[model samples]
Target: MKRIIVAITGASGAVYGIRALELLRKMDDVETHAIVTSSGQRTIAHETDYTPGEVRSLADHHHNPRDIGAAVSSGSFVTTGMLVAPCSVKTLSGIANSYNDELVVRAADVCLKERRRVVLMLRETPLHAGHIELMARATNNGAIIMPPVPAFYTLPRSLDDVVDQTVARALELLDVVMPGIQRWDGTSVVPDDG
Candidate 1:
């Protein structure tokens, strides 16, 4: 099983993290380790129907945000990758700077130092220079900043479609194959001009 560490932070888009967890649990090859920040718990309660306990049950292993000694908190402990769905700006800043203040931050820091794939599903809507700089720093340090931006071309029929598309892309960043979203391989054929 490929071990993956997933962190859910206090970002406003709580549904993204919840959906990602639900999807990840369905995949047989992944052994998911999850950390839900205190603020993240609040956000989940505020935005989604799931409780933190429910989400915790989905993970193969669940760590407390305060547990600095967790295996995932060290750079030496091996893992397939890490993903922070609905990563808050606060956590993003921590990851970019290598500040291991909390367990989630520490795990992310470990991912950067170990050169493992780290996917950050940044959830904030508005753009700012500081956010951009943090994104650049994380990317430079070998993390993928994946904002949950929807594709209009897909013509999604339900909210689940949008979530699946984003989750599939996030999985792709970790080199995990997901057939949830129909990919764009440029153009498969010429468009019919009837």
Candidate 2:
């Protein structure tokens, strides 16, 4: 079974993380391990319809955010990688600087040290120089800093369609192929005028 760790932070886009868990559940060969930060729990209550427990139940195994000795805390645990959906600026800073104070950051740091793929779906906007620098640092350390920007070409009619498109792209960064993802085929290319 392939182990994939999904971490949720306090970022505004809690739905992205929830959608990721829902999609991962459909796969029989993948095992999902989840860690929800305290801030993430609060955001789930405030932003989404589902309770924190309901969200955690989607994963095959759940670990408390404070549990530093959990199975995924070390590189030896052997995971495909870790994905931080809706990664907050604070969490991004921690990962970029190699701060392992929390399980989420620690697990991400372990993945980086082990040369494993770490995809961070940063949900912040109005980027400043500091945010850009941190993003650069994280990228320098082998983290794919993916912002959940909606693709309009997909012709998404509803909010759920937009969320699914973003979540599907995040899974692709982890090299996990999900069925039914709407991708751009580039078949209808438009000519650009100089």
Q: Which candidate number maximizes lDDT?
A: 2
Candidate 1 regions exceeding 4 Å error are 188-194
Q: What are the per-model C-alpha RMSD values against the true structure?
A: 4.0, 4.5
Report the lDDT of model 2 for residue 184. 58
Model 1, 46-152: lDDT tens digits are 88889999988889899999999998988778898898988999999999998888998899888878889999999876879999999999999998998989865
How does candidate 2 score on lDDT?
A: 0.91
Q: CA lDDT of each candidate?
A: 0.85, 0.91
- The estimated TM-scores of all candidates read 0.92, 0.95
Where does the lowest 10-residue lDDT sum fall in candidate 1? 185-194
- State how far residue 181 of model 2 sits from its true place (Å): 1.2
The candidate that achieves the highest TM-score relative to the unseen native structure: 2
Quote model 1's TM-score.
0.92
lDDT of 1: 0.85
Worst ten in a row by lDDT for model 2? 185-194
